[model samples]
Target: MPATRTLATREAADLIELTRSLAVNELSPKAAEAEADETFPREVFRMLGRAGLLGLPYPEEYGGGGQPYEVYLQVLEEVAAVWSSVAVGISVHALSCFGLAAYGTAEQKEKWLPGMLGGELLGAYCLSEPHAGSDPAAMRTRAVRDGDHYVLNGAKAWTTHGGYADFYTVMARTSDDRSHGISCFLVQADTPGLAADPPERKMGLTGSATATMHLDDVRVPVGHRLGEEGQGLRVALAGLDSGRLGIAAVATGLAQGAFDLALRYAQEREAFGKPIIEHQGLAFVLADMGAAIESARATTLSAARLKDQGLPFTREASIAKLVATDNAMRVTTDAVQVLGGYGYTRDFPVERYMREAKVMQIFEGTNQIQRMVISRALSRPAKGTITVLSEN
Candidate 1:
């Protein structure tokens, strides 16, 4: 079933329709094969880029679609419904651009934003290290200043699009001050000494590659530095505020997809001389799933609206991430139950959906981390307080 969204503009509605069409025609048909083959759908991304779907939340001057975050997130949701790996790739690409788009100077934006947002160049974010997944301040990666460049040495773990990305937005320590010592850099993939480890074999989203990126004295020009030195942590956190919302939107979409599948299965599969949907117990489960999906979607969109309004939405974003992902985990699991034995096998997509939903709780800051963020925010006086929780 298509989501009945109350969009703010006609253009937004049209965009969603276009995204649905694209997902149906381009993403859905190939999703299973790509995942089965563990193939990264690079051409699909390029196709989305050509269709102006890659840079929806960025400014138009830099070859972006210039759509608001609300519209962009909905497009992401629509895409996620059909192909989660592609949706995750789009979200990560947006995150990779966040530091540069939000903090880069005019010259930096003019020089790099065009290609980066143009969809011709894919990007990866490098912040999480083997030991520093949640505590970014504890990261050991270092970027020492040279005459005209910075020599970076450290490994970033769990990098999406790791081996295939055209550029990387990296956060590395530039000084001894844990919180204030980090700096952000835009590093080209072909830079000497930079390499990607073999992709991790994952239980789900196999079509999207995940690998550790090794930066062994990789030299990046000073001009590629984003924002001021010692301000990388701030830039990274700012990006994550938006990234959490992206994940929230994706989670809601995943739940919605699961709910739709379960509802359809219940309606068509007869049991006890009637459709299972007519059974009171199964009917109640479907009702709960529908309510959960609606609630998750509402929470996610509310956060996006707060962000679009330029309000302090860190707490709301965390809540959205926590609620939406947890709901997805539950909803997808129940969707498999709705399908009975078929859901457990690869013959149906619900099994894949269930597997894909698991990681949503783990990434973009774990659900526990989200709770910590919410708790910290609640502890503070409510006078425009924004909790600064570190996320990778």
Candidate 2:
């Protein structure tokens, strides 16, 4: 069952309807089989690209949908409810495009943005390294400037769409300055010395590929740089603020899917000569699941509203990410319990949902990292509040 949504515009409502229709007709049928086979659904992305769903958050000038972040996240949620791997891929794709879309030079945008937003080129973001996943500032990747190119050498770990993407947004150290040493570049996947290592064998989301990208003497043209020197970290963090909201939307969708499945099963399954939903204990659990999903959705949307209004949303984004993922984990686990023995077996998708929910709490800066971000923000005085520095 789809959750009721109140979109601000008829166009947004139509977009959501289109997304839900496509998800049901095209994605849901193949999701289980592809996941079971651990096959990367490259064609599915292309299909979505053709449907104009790949670039909903981008401007229409670059062949995108020009939708607001709120609408885009709802579309993502719709897709995620049917196929989480695809939904995650969509979010990662948006994240990959963020640097160029937000910081690229006019010439660079004119040259590359169309192809990227049009879906002619798929993108991957290269930032996290094996030893410096959380601490990007400590990354060892180097990009030495040549006459007209910057030769890169390092490996980016846990890259989504790794080998399959056509372009990569790479961040590498260009100087010794810890705070301002990194630079961002748009490197073509076909560039020499740029290759992806074998994909990682993960516990879930197998339908989407994750791998380490190796940049060994890969020369990226000077023009490919997204922003000025030493601005990569800023761009990366900004993108992550938006990316966390995307993950929150995906997690909410996953929880919704699980809850829907459990609700259907519970209403159909019998317990003590009545439907399991007739039991107060089970009913309370369903009620909690419904409440959690709504709360997570509201939190994610609130953060998105802040972003859309061009306000400071980093703290809110982290809060949304933390709350949504944690609630998803709970909702999915309860869903499994609702199905009892069937949920434990592969015959039902609740088991897979449980596995998929585990990773949501781990990625996009783990929930622990999110808590740190939130706490640090809380330590500061509120925007309008005056702080009196009095020694205790």
Question: What residue pairs clash in candidate 2, if any at all?
Answer: none
Given candidate 2, what's the lDDT at residue 68?
A: 86
lDDT of 1: 0.92
Candidate 2 lDDT by residue in tens digits, 297-336: 9999988987887778999999999999999999999999
* TM-score of predicted structure 1: 0.97
Per-model TM against the reference: 0.97, 0.97
Off by over 4 Å in 1: 383-392
Clashing pairs in 1: none
Q: Supply candidate 1's per-residue lDDT for 124.
A: 97
The whole-model lDDT of each prediction reads 0.92, 0.92
lDDT by residue (238-260, candidate 1, tens digit) is: 99999999999898888888888
